[model samples]
Target: MLLNQVPVFIFLIILSICEAKQLLDEEFGTDDVTSGLCDDFFHGTPWPLPHDSKGRGLARLCQNQIEDGKEGRIVFATMFSTTERIPVYTANTVVLHRDGKEHPRPGSKYWYRVSLALCSSDDHTFDPIESMIGHAEKHEMEQCRKFQAVTEDYTHNGLNLDRGHLSPNSINEQDLEKQLGTFTLTNAAPQFADFNREVWRVYECVAQHTILDYVPGEKVYIITGTHGVALDVNNNPWWMNGDDTDMDKNPVKIPGVYWKAFCYPGNKTHSAWGYAIVQKNENVYRKPDYNEYITLKEFNTRGIITAPFGPSCMDASFGVFSKVFENWDEYIDTKCPSYTKKKREEL
Candidate 1:
């Protein structure tokens, strides 16, 4: 009986090892088999390649919902010094809060960018992910090719708007690939220099620190995006100079407001918190007002932007843990008073 049981135990061990290898392959795209596994794992089928109508390979998250009326097609970025390959993981690994899209009318391209990754406290050094920018470049090149427009035409040159990152690099510092993934132009929107450098910049730092402090060593998802119309220095809506016929002449849409929301999936106490800042993309130089901080629900309700998580994620009570830090003002005052003080001094 003992001899018979030994064979069964050995078989079980072998099976476990095989499964472990398969999982690793699926996660890393080690080989063709792993590539197929990733496709099946994400799409649950192998019929259609993950390319969009433009023949660009969409990211796994974007591919999963191509049929769901998402606007812009997906484009995967290659690692800077490594071979070209798409990343694969379970949905819980990185949540694509919104898919990229090209909005109709005004011909203004509105790139919807937001995603989240779970962080491990073991490593905290934030490294730049150059691939994120590569993917964005690839996507922009595809768009340029479609219109027979030179790559320079797609640049926001002479527009006085800076290429702002919707999903900032600081949040995913733990993972090199994901950090690089944030560099893509697909994740960027045109932003006013003053707003981007002053107001939004400070909020980003506060949000990141809040996450690291509150959910230390836990799984946290950060979702961020931009919306609304861009304004000129005179507080007037800005549009491309030419008629809206060709992609070359089209102006990159500038968001009137930028928002960020973060969630701690591991937290049973509260779900998520979010805030929005309104910057008309003008020439004004001032720090963002911390008084603008609002609950995730209010931000969405007022802005008409969809919540990163479904509506259920919003806690109306504005509970203690809802905003990560108990007092937004206090946190800004204590943690980094310099951000606020410097703004006042400039004024």
Candidate 2:
């Protein structure tokens, strides 16, 4: 019996290792995967954005849905760097709350999301929610590509233009559960990576730094898109009759400033679906004025633009914003990280 135990012990050890690795793949996000953590900024009350239990649960946070994305898309900042880790078995690690559940810690921001890892094997299409979001982008892009204006101008309308996601593929199921309001198509945007990577990336970074936290966790809602806005040829923020379509007519609150737009991401069905937020007060954009932060309740009355499209509309606030920070330079950074000859022409 003693002699036979060796093989059994060895097999058990290997199994343990395999299990741990599998969990890591589910919990940790890779550069290649969807990176769905903050892919969609949920609005309204907290609810579960459930999947078929295919993903490995990672982390979650409770955050505000208020946003200000008149000129740019919302922010999608990481709460904690990959180098950081929180202990779970012993005390809850760096983000343990007194209740022993993950939430409301001093420095920690709790967000609810079906945070799935970025493993190529993991597909959002496995569930209906994924399909819905996917359909919206695909269908919209199909229509967008055919539009004469889109074909003529790829930035606003072009055959090659695509929809860029603000919220990423997340691995944390708990976080998805808390979203409860952002699963609407209204909170999306059309972007080119050259633009998203350079200008949009920087603009969003500012919002994440100010409103979103990484360590413990910060719950922040975000949305992105390009619409017919009233702007000068310089891409400056402006109010226009053509830009003032439906949702842009009303004033949107970001931080302390009340701004409005004519056309943007979330102004369709709910006629107020799209919204975003950022840091820094500009003569063109807004500065944070909603005290230091905004909460879900405030977002409910002010931020959330419309109800979700499908029955699974509980956890969703993909258009929430606390501020609307916009710097064309940063916006360019997000869209055109490196200005190429083509990019120069687009501008």
Candidate 3:
């Protein structure tokens, strides 16, 4: 199907073009954060299900919406359908709140109306999306329920496979071993190899070498998934270790609970700099800090944050560049990606 035939395509193209123009205008020192994604990105709340006309709603009690770079610290969202499935529209939303700053908090048992487009259903090969409709809850269960977790090899419906991050391998060992402990299978994702290999690496450097001071015992907890979460049994949204109080016999050890944080830099006391959970498929990692992003100046937005990590590093470690970049253009222009440069002794 040609783009000229679809109105949604027009929307994406128009937005892309506009974004391109905007980027061209301010080529150097881009502070613009296209923002985030699934699972850990939408924790502590009930995710909306697929609707009749609105596709699927992602509004939850604890979701931090993205922002429009052109608009000072405002949440932003987009609706698009793969060239294959036109009716199955995918609504991607992201928010850039100032950790330690004032902003809206997406807590548990809350209400939100972010995005819900009627997704298209025109499945075809290379149909504008290499990624398929990801599984929601059970997606990550392939290994979550299995003890002695398989760290290296894991898949979610076996789709857009990339550099699946299981532990703090050679890629993100930021000087601290326990902090790098997040590199466990419980902390992996289905990100593109280029993203994990090239771009996200830059963040590791900044997080380890650049941001020196941090609160001790600070840790990052992460979870990622598709569809609505059960808030039980599943391991994509929340993976708090040892939290089965209401049940008998501990079936899991990963932390399936929300940690703490403060607001980011720029904004008021709304959001925080704690676990910056990011994901591609059934995998999620607790981003201790979006360091590479700090230079972009994310301190002047939003207001408020109230969590344990409360926006500070919880004896945490490591960092990753955003994965919003879908293709080469993204890898080049936006991300200043680095790669695993660890020596033998470093490991």
Ranking by lDDT: 1, 2, 3
Write one digit per residue (lDDT tens) for candidate 3, span 89-198.
11212121223222232231111111111112222111122121112144443332232223223223232334233322332233222222223322333343444554
Q: Which residues of candidate 2, in runs, are more than 4 Å off? A: 1-162, 168-189, 192-195, 209-215, 223-347
TM-score of 3: 0.26
Summarize candidate 1's per-residue lDDT along 84-120 as a digit string, tens digits: 1112111212322122221222212223221311011
Q: Please give each candidate's TM-score.
A: 0.51, 0.25, 0.26
Model number with the top TM-score: 1
Clashes of 3: 95
lDDT of 2 by residue, 59-161 (tens): 2221223323112122222221111111000001011122233322121021211121211122222211121111113334433222111111222332122
What TM-score does structure 2 among the candidates reach?
A: 0.25
Per-prediction tally of clashes: 8, 96, 95
- What are the RMSD figures for all models against the true structure? 15.7, 21.1, 19.4
Evaluate all candidate structures by whole-model CA lDDT and list the values in order. Answer: 0.42, 0.28, 0.27
* Whole-structure CA lDDT of model 1: 0.42
Candidate 1: regions farther than 4 A off: 1-156, 233-236, 240-250, 265-280, 316-347
> Judged by lDDT against the true structure, how good is candidate 2?
0.28
